[model samples]
Target chain A: MELVEKYLYAIGKKLPRKQKRDIVEELRSLIIDNLEDRVKEGEPTDEDISQILIEMGSPAEVAKKYCTGTQWLIGPQLYDMYLMMCKIVLGALLLGYSVSIVVSLFSSLSGSGFGQIMWYIAKNLLSIIPGILAAIGAVTLIFAIIERTSKKPLDIDFAEGGKWNPSKLEPIPKKEEVVKPIESILGIVFTVFVLVLFYFYRDKIGFYYMSSLGDNWVMVKIFSQSALRTYLPLWTISWVLSLGMYIWLLCIGKYNMLARVFEMIVSALNIGILFFMANGPHLFEFDKLGADFIDLQPAVDFLTNNQSTIFYILAVLSIFGLLANLGKLIVGKVKGRI
Target chain B: MGNNQHTTDGLIQELRRGTLVLSVLSQLKRPQYGYSLVQCLAQKGLNIEQSTLYPLLRRLEKQELLKSDWELTGTRPRRYYQLNENGKEMLQELSDEWNRLAEVVKKLTQEEEIK
Candidate 1:
């Protein structure tokens, strides 16, 4: 009787809350019925009861038949995607954090030693961990809900897609038109690198002209903080367009007329934005640059006085570069070279 | 186990699983409690695990093929199951299908034997 009660309790624990009481009662009665029948001829000992329960099977195995729902937080269906998301997010976080920490530390290397720099980076990485964990938790929760609701596995391939039609497959990319995955991936990395660069290390950018401050020659940037702010919006749109084009190339894996035209449009927009920023208020901010050092006086005077001329030179160069690429792409399309 | 023995066991297990419902329905014309049905089927040489039978019985009842009620039989309460109208119809259709399948299997095996 003691053994039977314990066995019932074990199985009862595994039962779902909604149907627990009734299921437990039914299971208990079955056990008692089987037990009473076993010793009907004579009163049995505890050994007999235990032996009978043993033949019936373990509590977990018996309960498993009644409880078919999986208990895992993320089931097998969504595990691959969960793993992949974590890899991508954590990889980017680590890469960007390390780069920024190094740049920020290197800029202000006056009082801090190597150990201090290392400690600062280590502390910052630890501080950002909660944000990373929050991101991971959100991804896991979304996937877990999907795993429960989604009936089919999430690995349906392009050719084996649920609604795939043979006619939907495009023609094989021509040799010249083939968008190499390595090239497209490099483009995406470059765009992402620039995003990280401007977001964290914007001050580190621009011409770091070596100028004498007393006996020491320190690097001074020609573009002031205000000048960088003027370029921010232009840089943002260019970054977005570049990233978008990279994704489009990755998905299509070829140079179609649509992609070529999109690239051309983005290049035109960037060129226009560059010229507009060059002609904006306080382009070089020579009045401000004059205070940096006496040694940079000549360079600053020439830059400030000839600011429009220098900007026009830059604007014309970028225009020529973009126009040449556009011409090459058009010629390639016409000749089926790309 | 030998590959031939493994194949036979798998085939027999599948065959038993497919026909388990039909066998249970045929015996459920009269109301029977869980253990009683287990013994009744055992006597007819269709032994099933007690654990498997209980859930299968509940599922069939939930599906409306079987109707169950709790009755105080002797000292303890027992859940007795009886076939519903749906169960009776299902049993007849399954019985016909079983006959057809058995005949096909017999003819196929006989041809294999000759080969």
Candidate 2:
């Protein structure tokens, strides 16, 4: 009985503090009672008592039986959601950090002083927004997982027979109650606002910036005259495409399947646009417009020096975003099944 | 002849087995110590093994159907068991159901035997 007490104590120590004492006392009483009954039946040997204890099963098994009720609050159902959130957050952070470092290096190499430094910092911060969101999401997901696994109130439903009868209990509103519609509305409003802003501010924004010119004689002359001209249209086109994609995503991306398909299409369009912009003029005979454009030296140098690197970076980021959306889609599918 | 007797005894045991739990529960409604309870039930023709009765008592206590209190009478302390509130309710329901089912079974079996 002393040995059994010691065994029970060891097992009880593993359990939560609140339950340990009652369980230990009950176990002790049971063992002693059994032992005394055995002794009266003429099986009074020490060896026999030890053999009986051994035959009854391990201390852990006994402890487990006592602790079996209400094992988890949210249960084992939401484990997949936790894992998916983890992947998204980690991937976002990795992508953000890499892009920040690369962009910072480019800005420093370009030698564009204090304004450029401020721009670099602002851009990096903006780029890291998704990463920060991912981190917060990951932390929340971990808390949710812990809450699910712990057999606590608010998450646990402890009725006999393993069926979730919601009619028996009150329901709490879900997180998506406020955020989902708000997010969709904000996304659409922001996209439309940016488009309008760009349309109205085009001239003011591009006044000193000579790269807004089309492929006319005057525009060719302007391009030949200015070193920044060739790069401006490229930036404008890229920005418009990005904004277009954002609006498209906001409009049609409520469903995971549609969002994933849209993401793929946008990713492909980005790559295709970058490819054409990098090599378009050479194939289109825009080089043969006049003497001013015929040289093509300034435009070629500008495109050669900057286009490939910029396009490569954008392509990578877009692919990363696409992969993140894909991750979201897979998570949604898994969550649906669960 | 002894083998035939043993077979008949085993058949009787099997036939009477389902009533053992109800019989034990009914006795424990009145506060009774373990050994005394066993002797009392045996006198009523519901003979049960000590091993089986002890475990069943413990299980009932665990299920909150039985309550026990230890009283030291003479040299050794004896644990007395009694039916709890839940146990009383369950016992009443079980008794009612058993009577109804037994009557139906008796009617059917008697009619078949007559035919």
Candidate 3:
């Protein structure tokens, strides 16, 4: 009985005080009833009682059955709130640190001395503060939305004898049920159109500006004069092919796989283009290229001369596009059948 | 139209069933043990079963919306249930919404009767 009490207490401690006594009392009675029954059957030894208790199962198991409907975590409920708050605070801090670093780097590079660096850091911190607050606000807003939408009770049951069954929970809204195929088709078409527009307008938008300023822009003149003129047509062609593939995939209702493949291909090609644009000039001097290839000089020279900067920009843009596309793909996947 | 009436009744029952938890939560603002709570609600015509009430109390306690503690009343220790802070806030909001809904429903039904 003492052993049973100890076991019951251990389990009861995990439950709310309101349930603890009832569950403990009920469990005690059960063990006593079991023991008495066993004794009546002529097994009166202490060893027999111990064996019977063991057969009844571990103290944890017995307590679990009695407190089957209770929930227990490592600590109080407020601890969860604290953890959530900490995550938000830490995320904000990291974003602030990165922004500060970028601002400082730019300020120093532009010949803004120590004072300017400090000012930039302060300005960056101030700018990021609202963003952090907005992120936190967004999280809260999402929580409110979920709370408002959720029709079920707050309890989550995961116990041996608990009546809680996850299967009984409402089914998640299916992706296909929510998003129609037409919407996805439109999205794919829109992205392709944007890519095509950019490709066609490459030269007019001063694609060669980064390599050759032509006495128009200081930043443009400083950078390599690699005219992306040659790659423009190829890029446009690739975009059209990728767009066609996307449309075909969407029509067949295989948007996810198609988007992933397309993103990977585009990212690879963009990275390659950026690399060539940055390194082509350094790899082959203008004297070697002769006057006939002067037009191509800007593209090659820009790539070779400003390889790091070009790579950084392309990598960033590619990664950003990849992430955006990946997000859409995942949303589409989760919204299954749509 | 006859089938529609039946469907509407069913929908009303379904809606009430969904709000049963909220109703339970509202009643548990003051400390009331399990049997007492069941009796109190039954007297008020909520008509909740013991099996349902017990499980719901457990669930509410688990959610931290309700707090429970055992008191040695008589020979048997009885578990007393009370609404927690979050439960109080939730009950207030739900009550306001419920009242507003009831008013709207009453006005709509009255308008229908006139028609």
Candidate 4:
């Protein structure tokens, strides 16, 4: 009686885990008991069991009494969709920034060059972080609505094949495909931590060099108060943007074309911003050159005056990093790792 | 059926829905298997869907109002259900409540009849 077995199996799919086996066994016996009582008068056929199953009603309706506590903001069913929305937002941000960089390159070929521009963008990475938080919030809000409004949670097959199997429940992610949400979250936290540190206690960035003369030590204030005050507004903007990148990474769990492009844009912008900031101010202070370091005073002063040059040099070196990530993104896309 | 009959069916189903647990509990004093319970209820002119009754029995069992066990009798296995101590207590309380409700309904219906 494959038909009868199939019916029991369908009903079995709906029962809670602990009670599934016992309920199925008891139900099977009941159905068989009914079948035998009917066939006592004559021979049994599949048709008889089919009629029995029909009278039993839907498996969902039967399963309803047994099921408990499915209410949630975004249950397992909508988790993937929520993640997708986050990816789309992040990807859009990345594309927008990349396009902006490309446009800037085309228009502004006269001043401070690519290196300075990239360094400027890199430094402002902090201000962009809040955008990530907002994107995640938006996705969560939409999914919460969907979860609440859905008439029947079971209407969507949260599990593949409409029945849960341990093997199929959570397939092992490939190395390249893993999202590393923890790492992304940590990076966001680190960024926020740095911002807080910079705001409250930034004068501690100088050098403590021991003099060769006689254990005489002197402290140099490397970072100026003006760095925090003047750049606070710009830093806030870039921090919010950086927050978006981290949040998108956390929510989406993995990088795709969009994330890669977003990364590229963010990297480019960061480098550019750092370069721009370098051009604007001393950015660093080495006023306490001491007696021994007076010979290097001219070099220190030149670097201090042209801090943007250092960022430009660093930005050129970071191109290798951006290229490597872009390569990984391309490869991951081809392999369906994304 | 017509719209009038549709409303009647829906209303009657709602009425029957409330009494299903009571109806099943009334008969679980003696051990009865799935088909046997269905036949017992059907014979008494209380029609319950076989699918409905089986799950209902399982739910009542879960609620500790009914207990069930599988028995191998004759050629095959059969699951026999009987009211447990909890079920007996519930049945008694529910029976008393049903009686009061039925009495009140009868009085009201008699008034309708008079009208």
Candidate 5:
């Protein structure tokens, strides 16, 4: 009798809450009926109860049979997308972290000792674990909510019965029309890495070297504080917008009119920022390197002399890139590929 | 040899899974408590475990194919299940489909044996 109660309790605890009591009671009655038929003469012994429970299988197994609805946080319909998103996020984080670590090491090499460099590398590597974990959690949480809230077959349109149209199913996109996830993932990683570099290590963007074997290492920051401060906001905005657009394209998984328009706007912003910076200020701080650095002074002087010309070249390159992107968009539109 | 026996058991289980629902539904035309239904099916040489049958009964009731009530006035309380209108219609349709499927399978297998 005690064993039966224990078995019933084990099964009951695992059953879905709404139907738990009824299921438990029904199972109890079934067990009792089986007992009455078998142990006709007297109170059922432990042996009889054990046999009945054993035949019914384990408590967890029985409970699972009665669990009617979905028991997954992310159901099958969304599971593939969830897995892909996880892979993308993890890949992006790893690439971005490695790039940042290498850039940081290069920027700091002139000033820091070998031991310090090793410590920095260790710290950067350790930091990646938490970032990876948090990103995974965020992706999982988003998919879980979608699984619970959305209709089954998660990609189903919201349009009611007759509102849908066969014409709305666009033709199979050409290779170029499809937004390759890897491209967007790379774009996302690059934008995030650049943004982090400029925001946190703005002064470290420079030249670093030792003039001679016994000489102390020296570094000269390329950009003046005022110049960097002036451009930081624009850089931040452009990169943030690019990051958002890349993520959106990744989710949509195709190139279309809306994406084309957004890409053009971001390109225009880049052109404007580069052109303005090209004409704006004495962009590099040449005095910081000075004439005293024996081996590197000539190189520093040459860079100082040609800083404006360099900026102008960069601006022209950017303009060309923007034109190329615009031309592709036009071609895609004419071909009905967008 | 053990692996072969295991494979055979799995295939047999897969074959039985669909028909188990039809078997339970066929027996539910008359009201029967969980134990009695189990016993009746067992007597007919259709052995279903108590755990399987009880949950299946609840599921059928949930689907509105069967209706049930607790008979507390009996010596001991027991929930009795019988087919509702929907269940009768379902059973008829399923029976027709099963007969056709059985005929097709029988013909194909017989032809294979002849060859």
Candidate 6:
């Protein structure tokens, strides 16, 4: 009887909470009926109970028989998009972090030996793995929520009173008009990653040098407090707008003239910010570079002096991007493709 | 050979699954508890598992095809299920459909055998 109780308890644990008590009670009645038939003279043993339970099926298998519809966190409709999002995000994280660590290693090479720098890179890389895992978990949770809550997941609404009609489906776009999902996904990932980096790790973006004590590496941030304070808000706004635009493009799965105009405006604003920084103030500062970086002082001085040149180069590249986009827009308009 | 047997068993299960609702509906013409229903079906050479039949009975009840009550007069409480008016109508329609399907299947199989 205790074995029978234990078996029922196991099955009850897996049963849906709403129907748990009633189902368990019905099962108990059935089990008792089986026992009465089998154990005519004496009480049914654990072996008898075990045999019945085994015949009934495993607890999970039994419970699954009661569950209706999808029992998964993410359903079939959103699974492909969720998987694509994960791959894009994880790939970006790996590439971004790897590049950052390698850059840090090279910058601090004069402070530490090659082996020591490699060791630091490995440790830093290992530490970021949890962050990557959290990112994947966040993505899975969001898709799961959408799956649970949305009647038509991923905007794949059934046409005309929920009856899916194949003939009414939109024709596939031409190559030129097709908004590449990968492009939008990559753009979203890059913008988000960059925004996070600038927001959280702005202070860490600098020359890494071994301190005079030789006990630890120190970072001398490239941007002055004044510079970051001035640009941070502007950078956040533009990048956030880019993020929104990419998300919109991803959802709509196509590009339009308005999107092109929005992109151009964002690009123009970015270039404007770059040119302003280049001309307005001495953005790079080496005040934190101590005597430890004396040997690297000349190189740092050169970089600080030519920081404006770097900004000019960035602005020029952005201008070229803007022109290229403008050219495409004009061509599209002329061809009546927009 | 083992794979072929497994495939055949799967097909047989699928075939049986299509008839399961009809079988359960047919039995509900008389009030029967879960275990009594299982026994009744087994006696009729249709051995449905308890796990499958119990949930199905609940589902049918929810669908308003069957009505159930907890009969607590015995030593242990038993949930007795019987066909409601809706259930009786559904059973009649399903029985007619099943007979029609059976005739088609029989004709097809007989023709195959002759060929």
TM-score of each: 0.65, 0.39, 0.31, 0.46, 0.79, 0.80
Candidate 3 per-residue lDDT over residues A1-338, each given as its tens digit: 56666666776776557767766664465455456645777645777667756755565654444455325331243345434543534443554356435533543334456787678767867866765677566655655554556445433333336466667654553464343445554555455444533443222232222124222211112222254545555566666666655544543344346456675777777767666655444322233343444677778677656666866687778777877877877787787676
As a whole number from 0 to 100, the lDDT of residue A20 in candidate 3 is 74
Q: Report model 2's TM-score to 2 decimal places.
A: 0.39
Please tell me what DockQ candidate 3 reaches: 0.02
Cα lDDT tens digits, model 5, A1-338, are 88988999999999888889988988999899899889989788899999989998899989988988678998877787788888877877777677767767665554578899899989888988987899899989988887878764545463557476666566676787798888888887777677766776676667665555634555667778898898889878889999989988887788877888898898788878877777777677754654456667777778777877877788788778878988887886787653
Q: After superposition, how far is residue A283 of candidate 5 from its true place, in Å?
A: 5.5
Candidate 6: how close is chain B to the reference, as a TM-score? Answer: 0.94
Give the alpha carbon lDDT tens digit for every residue of A285-320 in model 2: 222234434465666556546755666677777778
Best by DockQ: 6
Q: What TM-score applies to chain A of candidate 4? A: 0.44
Error of 6 at A335 (Å): 3.1
RMSD of every prediction: 6.6, 16.7, 20.7, 21.1, 4.4, 4.6
| Candidates sorted by lDDT, best first | 6, 5, 1, 4, 3, 2
Model 3 chain A: lowest-lDDT 10 consecutive positions = A216-225
Question: Backbone clash tally for model 4?
Answer: 44
Candidate 1 chain A: minimum summed lDDT over ten consecutive residues — where? A208-217
Sort by DockQ, top down from the best: 6, 5, 1, 4, 2, 3
Taking chain B only, the TM-score of every model is: 0.91, 0.85, 0.84, 0.91, 0.94, 0.94
Task: For candidate 4, write residues A1-338 as lDDT tens digits.
Answer: 88878877888897887889887787777777777767787767878988766767777776775564674578997787577556656655454444444433333322455688777567445545675677678778978987888765533234655675566444455677577866786666656555554554365445555565744445566666776577777776677777778877776676655777877887877776677676776577776688877887898788777777787788777777888887877776787654
lDDT, residue A86, candidate 4: 67
| Full-model lDDT for every candidate | 0.76, 0.59, 0.59, 0.73, 0.83, 0.84
lDDT of 1 by residue, A1-338 (tens): 77788888898898788877887788778877787878887777899888878867788888887776478888876676578656554655566667766555545543476798788877888877985798688768877888787766554434555676677566787897899866776676667667767776777654332333433223345556787787778878988898788766865678888888888788778778767766775566533332455677887788777877777787788789878978887777687653
Docking class of 5: medium
Give stretches of model 6 more than 4 Å off: A69-73, A90-137, A177-189, A207-222, A244-262, A285-320, A333-338, B1-3, B106-115
Stretches of model 1 off by over 4 angstroms after superposition: A1-6, A41-59, A69-79, A98-125, A141-338, B4-12
Query: Which residue runs does candidate 5 get wrong by more than 4 Å?
Result: A41-47, A94-130, A148-170, A177-180, A199-220, A223-229, A248-258, A279-309, A332-338, B1-8, B73-75
Query: Which regions of candidate 2 fall more than 4 Å away from where they truly are?
Result: A14-16, A40-46, A83-338, B1-27, B31-64, B73-81, B94-115
How big an interface RMSD has model 6?
A: 0.9
**Residue B53 lDDT in model 1?**
86
Q: Global CA lDDT of candidate 3, please? A: 0.59
Q: Native-vs-model 4 lDDT?
A: 0.73
Residue A135 in candidate 1, Cα distance off native in Å:
2.3
